[model samples]
Target: MKETAYLLQAALISAWWVGLASNGVFFAAFQFDAIPSTAFWAFFAPDVILIAALSTVRAYKQNSAIELVILGAFAYASLYCVNATVLTASGYLPTGLMLLGLAYNGFLCFSDSAFRVSSTSMTWNAIKTLIQTVCIWTMALVIVPYVILDAFDTFALPSMDIWLIIGGLLFACFSLLGLTSAFFMVRDGAGTPLPLDQTNHLVVSGPYHYVRNPMAISGIGQGLAVAIIFQSVPLLIYTALGVLIWQLVVRPIEERDMTRRFGESYVQYCRHVSCWIPTFGRRGT
Candidate 1:
């Protein structure tokens, strides 16, 4: 029998597939213009091979190594393709698909293993987290912003040089905070920040002591910084939308998971720590 976690992952992948297809069709037919048919197929075509391979492994194999190999190849090709078309109108589609596809593929890999967070070595966890961070940053800060705001020549502020300097400074500071927090997670907690390989221990020694989610706080700040640097209203709104998603949707679920895993210890910590604002004098117990 599959673990509940793995089951949820599978369900989520299925739902994503259905939702994207249905919504695309609906919007195209009744509400708004849709992406080109070829662009849409380009996004989903590779997944056909991937799904078949992963299903094969699930049925007869003991591990997902072969599936992982194929995914790696596809992901590598996707990186090159992303670079080539990043400035194009429909480029966001493939870029977004790459992120979601890797996540779904990882879910399939977890299906084969009796999975648990922090089961891998700290080194592997750190490596995975770093790579994931770079990919997401490339998408959010570089690719998507250029495609959405820059390529289309969106409205930009006049005094952007000064704003750029300030935003760059803020980005560096928040990035340092995020990296430092990740290092603490790896060294002290024996895991990474990503859910697939989260810390085994409750990490409260560094930034976690001041806030329950320093990484999240840093991430939102970094997004805001990017928006400021770009001086694009659309980018600012995009970052704000992401903040809203994290706060309203992701935070509650994450807190529940932490409480479930860490029990009274987490509950007690939550009492002292704020989720968004960092406290200076007191630390979580």
Candidate 2:
């Protein structure tokens, strides 16, 4: 069953890749703008729908931590895609390709099997928390610091496009959303409330009540926001691609893992809450 699940997931992912490659090639050949965003959504939406349809018959085991970490990488790649696309569309050929390559490599590095496994549910969620730690740390220690230093020492507001500024605001909102989930994970232990090597606990605090994968949502939001900030067509496309990839790879893995880890408890949660968005009445308070 596990093998079948893996194979099915793998096949769907491969199809998505093929679709992306085809779209890219078609765009290049025709000298037209390749809206990979639409293509990606179109190609993978079916896979998601199909998987969702079949999940009722047999639940797939998943790894939440692994999926979240990969998602972080997906967010990074999405940023690159949008940025690179913009450069390319703007007629900066070599630079565009370079950014494009960078985005691809970043995603490739993070999407390996080793990086996609969380042995226990607690560990799976903890792994996501750890990723947030890394991201938030980088934002605090590197990106933010650099931005601030540049702003203060140079006496200049960073050269940001209006889109990028918008992206930044979006990122802030999403990052906060992710942090909400992260806090619950930290507070509970791997599954929630603090770091632990052991897997246990089911979190129902902070952002969990509002959504299942707030961190994933935040990561995606940040990616889109960054794409806007960069205003890069490639980046934006990549952002869309990233979301598709997350829906394809990360979400399924987490869902399966959580379902297995929590069983009826998770089943109950699924009934009451959603995987990404909130239930109709439950607001993120």
In terms of TM-score, the best-performing candidate is 1
lDDT of 1 by residue, 12-101 (tens): 445555656777532232111234556545645554445433444444554556656645745765674466455443445445545555
Q: Candidate 2: TM-score?
A: 0.49
Question: On a 0 to 100 scale, what is the lDDT of residue 163 in model 1?
Answer: 89
CA lDDT of each prediction against the hidden true structure: 0.65, 0.51
* Candidate 1 Cα lDDT to native: 0.65
Could you tell me which 10 consecutive residues in candidate 2 have the lowest summed lDDT?
A: 147-156
RMSD of each: 8.6, 11.9
